[model samples]
Target chain A: MAALAPLSTYALRLGDDALILGQRLSEWCGHAPTIEVDLSLANLALDLIGQATHFLGVAGDADKLAFHRDALDFSNCLLVEQPNGDFAQTMARQFLFSTFQELHLHALASSKDERFAAIAAKAVKEVAYHRQLSSDWVVRLGDGTEESRARMTAGLDWMWRFVDELFQMDELEAKLAKGGAGVDKSELRAEWDRRVDAVLAEATLARPASRRPVLGGRRGHHTEHLGPLLSQMQFLQRAYPGAVW
Target chain B: MQDWPLWEVFIRAKGGLSHRHAGSVHAADAKMALEHARDTYTRRMEGVSLWVIPSAQIISSDPADAGPLFEPAEDKIYRHPTFYSIPDHIKHI
Candidate 1:
């Protein structure tokens, strides 16, 4: 196997995260509880897909990288690939992930590597809106009626274990950070915690207890959910290579 | 399952322009109402700004009294700016 550059891997990791989460959000296209909610979700999905395209484009041919990669070769974090359990669950995943992503991109916008910096600069604004959408939902569901509160809590529970993995820095990330091409994830945790905690407080929701961190998605190990997601997402390209609409 | 209140959405296509009624959406609160308005109305870049007012709060004149409300104004040509011609040199009047 040809060894991939650390920077390329980093770009792919972020790209895959956006692509997978966008795919998950796309599942809500026709199924969201309300037409407004459906439009919001779809818009957010489009934003993520746009981000994915830019990130993957920087790494290589965006379409080929997205459609042809095997599941084992993808670098998205496990948190993004988790099934959208319910509205609350989906919101929880989105809130947690977008919060982290926004913070990370803010730091990456100042990266020494101009390419990473440029991409991150553009993505930061889009992720800001995404973060707002998720955060609002989190507050609403958390402070809402008994059923919504319970569902929101359960959703947080479903996602909390994966939170730690987002801040875990492997050698590649550490090297990139040292070279100013990547963010030091550890530095982002405190701010992420502050923003999340404040929102949870306002929503009258308690933070979930910490558990064993589920790691390895950055290293290509993912939950079973990703296989089916990739199959559905990549179907057109796989079935009809080079076909253009 | 609870239905939210309806909000009337207005959009200003550009800066320094009055907001015109665009559409309406249902939301539980003011913030959500604004969000829904943006999601629903601004997808095509139709406006630079938005206003969301609760539909119930707006009092409209009775359409049955249309003649009394507007018919008299229809013939008030003197009130029309177009009644006077501006000098060509007064450009953009």
Candidate 2:
């Protein structure tokens, strides 16, 4: 065997991001500000879950990877778990995450591995929709009323610090990039910034200055938020493993 | 306070198609009606478009009047294709 390329650590990381965001989005299933938006978010959540399944299923299956993994094993960054603050904050987190994911998945679509490329190609379309959905909301909520604008900017301010964790590619990512299984996230920064800046401008929000970079999530550390999220999501599944109704 | 009115949902599966009646939901206004329709009915990618109208505005006829409104058209041969000569060019029909 050619060692199977160490199970594509980068794919695992991407899967973590999708799986977590899917779980997060599922939180809005019934309580969205409007019912149309509720359905829209649910559809997007399903898409993310589907994409996560595609990536996590590459090695085996997503169910096993998602519910079976412990705290230290997850590779998702901290930003996704920061809770849905307000409408604007939710959109801001989504806008930033989807913008980042759009470029990442686009470049991954060209991967030398056919399976990876196919997954990325399919996922890019879904993420494009996600980015558009979030961008639209960001503009509306950011420019809506005085209170809403303040909340939107405040949400973005709180969320911006976690963004540095997203682009911190390390040795595993470097190996995967060299092997053509993943993109060098470093090469995608300029495009990411341009897209983000344009959306922010349209939203009439400013980016917060960062004093330092954040990078603990890929190494198994996350904010206090993810634990509670996982507990709720995994509770029934964990309690009734292999027990089907 | 009175509750919101009930609205029936009709959905178009795709463009250039008819909107078939799907179901009903309760909403405070037309916008809320549409929003509730989307959430309750279209979450599964079930329809490409939707129409939500209050049930009271549907102007449905009584079941007793069905015979008068619909039964007369049943045996109208002029309305049917039974009078038309079969042409070979109209193969599918």
Whole-model lDDT values for every prediction = 0.92, 0.82
lDDT of 1 at A27: 97
What DockQ would you assign to candidate 2? 0.24
lDDT of 2 by residue, A96-207 (tens): 8999999999999999988889999999988997887788767766867798889888888878988877788888788888988778998888898998889878878777
Q: Tens-digit lDDT track for model 2 on B1-93? A: 046678999999989989999998877668657766876797678899999989999887899999999999887868766877897888877
Q: What are the C-alpha RMSDs, in order, of all predicted structures?
A: 1.5, 5.2
Clashing residue pairs found in predicted model 1: none
Second chain alone, TM-score for each candidate: 0.80, 0.81
Q: Is the docking of candidate 1 incorrect, acceptable, medium or high quality?
A: medium
Task: Give the number of the best model, judged by DockQ.
Answer: 1
CAPRI quality of model 2: acceptable
Q: Write the per-residue lDDT of candidate 1 for residues B4-69, one digit (tens) a residue.
A: 989999999999999999989989999989988988899899999999999999999999999899
- List model 1's recovered fraction of native interface contacts, to 2 decimals: 0.67
